[model samples]
Target: MRVLFFSNPLVAHLLPQFPLARALRGQGHTVAFSTAEVMAPWLAPEGFELLLSGPSAEEVTDEVARRTGADILFSPTSQLVGAYFAGARVDLSLDEALAAARYWEPDLILHEHLDFVGPLVAAVLKLPSAAVATDPALEPDVTEALTAAARTRCLERGLELPSRVPSGRWLLDLCPPSLERRGALSPRERIALRPEPHEGPAGPTRARRAPVGDRPRVLVGLPHAAGATAGLGPVLRSLGTLDVDLVATTPGDPGEGPGLEPGRVELLPFTPAAELLENVSAVVHHGGSGSTFAAAARGIPAVVVPGSEAQQRQAEPLAAAGAGLVLPPGRQDPASVTTAVGRLLADPGFTVAAHRVRDEIAAMPSAVQVAEWLVASVSARRGR
Candidate 1:
């Protein structure tokens, strides 16, 4: 079978689909990507056939900002979601994406949750499509907003909208039920896949074996999308005061910051959080879905300093699950960050909860298993 995958140009958005894509390829299906030109380089290294759908991510972001008159980085979740769907600039790539879809004529369309173009093309072509979750907490809202936007766009183009919003057939859920937003969407089918930890282009280079020492090891990682490393310095200084050994992946140059205590904090360039999690006892991060799930998959507790409303939402469920703690909004300073890390380290319950969540994730079906199901589902539909 041939599958067409669509995603926004952002690296974070694209990484979630990799495991499944790889699995499908291994199963002897052809998989191609439809995304912005900016993503082409990243896709080239992975050997996937890339069909250009739009301009660079930077151009699209700027376009969205120009159309909405809001900094997407700082905008509220609702505003960002609404703007992303309704903004004229966001749709600039749709015409090309549709043309690519028509040319490829894929048997299946699987897209990252935020890329509405997948569903729109699927509806127009009367092809099967599924929405793959990137951020579990945001999928419902994304589905609603994208569905409404797609419906309007379809009508304007003199086409009928699909019965469902983003997906004509299924919602491919990678997150465990416990972590996802309750009743986010009423999909015709929900396919559960184990959340495999994969670090795409930016993953760690050499696997450093677990830090060999008596002192507990803690990892501090900032999300690339966060775009600023200013907050990391203070947090690093605070973690420096603790007795634990600290390893941090700085957003920018690690040398710009004030010197941390020699053995207490070690700052390095961006490495995959999953790589670092293998050696760490606890994590302090910006609470992106990838980081949060990576930490959980390894049974590592986290202290989440949410950088946005969506991150805040992701953090809340992790904190509630007892796997981590969320630093209150505006309390992401040195003192608060230090205190949360201290709590996670000192408390045994957090470790216990982390392990439980890990076990839950481990119990889910692997990506290969999900690939089999996907193929069977498609074949069954064809037979009918």
Candidate 2:
């Protein structure tokens, strides 16, 4: 079957759906991604076809700022964010995505839940689509904002997408049952789709970091929306107080602050999370679904410092499961970050909880199983 997928232009939004896409391909389904050019680097390496659509995230952010006269970068409201995803983004993306889908003639369409263009494409083509939830449930305001804006944009385009995207069809839930917020999805078929760390072109080998030795090793990451972040220098430096050796994937130099032991922390350009997590005792990162699921999938405890509500949504569940701890945006000072990492490494119970969550994730159905289910659902819709 020809399956086409849609997503926002960021890796965090796109990577969560890779496992299922890979699984669908493994089952002999031809799949392609319809997204912005910024994703080409990620999608190409994964051997997936890139059907370029939509503006890059940075462009969308710029557009939003222009339209709203407010920069919602550090602090964003649902309305402004929704304006980008459902309003501005739709205006830019719908035509390109529609063109791609028309050419691809896909039997099924799947998209990240927040990506507005997907639902509209499905509506215009009169084809079936599924919403892939990258994180646990979003807050009601977020969902409603996106839905209302999407509805508005569709009217502008003379399109007819459903009011509630996931409710209109399937919701491929990536969150394990233990961490899922109940009733986030409608009474639709919410399938369990396990999350996996997106591997490099050549798999984990190409991205592996050097071996660590002696003291406990900790992995650190700072993601700015999608890739590694450069803003965690204070937190990264504070780790010097601990005995653990550090490896960090940060975009820019995380200059060492006072108290950080020099040469103990190794910094690199964006490395795969699976590679960075190898032989590491714990993770310290800004909360993102990709990083959170990577840590959880590996039974590695984490210290999540979230800068936004979206980040908070992904962090809270893991912390609730006792697998990690959260440091809210305003509270994650150097001392607090240091303390959180220290606590996770010292307490064996955190590891125990992490493993329990890992076990739950393991018990969930594989992507291949979910892929088969998707195929069946599509065939049934065609009255096959």
Candidate 1, TM-score vs. the true structure?
0.91
TM-score of each: 0.91, 0.91
**Residue 66 CA error for candidate 1 (Å)?**
3.3
**lDDT for each residue of candidate 2 in 285-367, tens digit (9 for 90 to 100):** 88777788888889999998886766787677788999999998677887988898899988999999999989988988888
Candidate of highest lDDT: 2
Off by over 4 Å in 2: 157-161, 183-187, 205-213, 225-231, 252-263
Off by over 4 Å in 1: 77-80, 86-90, 139-145, 162-164, 200-204, 207-212, 224-227, 256-258
Q: Summarize candidate 1's per-residue lDDT along 1-384 as a digit string, tens digits.
A: 999999888888887898899899989999999988788777887789999887766676677788768766566456566557534434787889888888888999999877777777887788888888777765556556656666677788787765654455788887876677775555567888788666655456765755647888988886655545766677777887888888878765677544765656677786655576766899888888888888888988999988776678778888889999998788877898899889998999999999999999999888899889999999999999
lDDT scores in order:
0.79, 0.81
Instruction: Flag clash pairs in model 2.
Output: 222-228, 222-229, 223-229
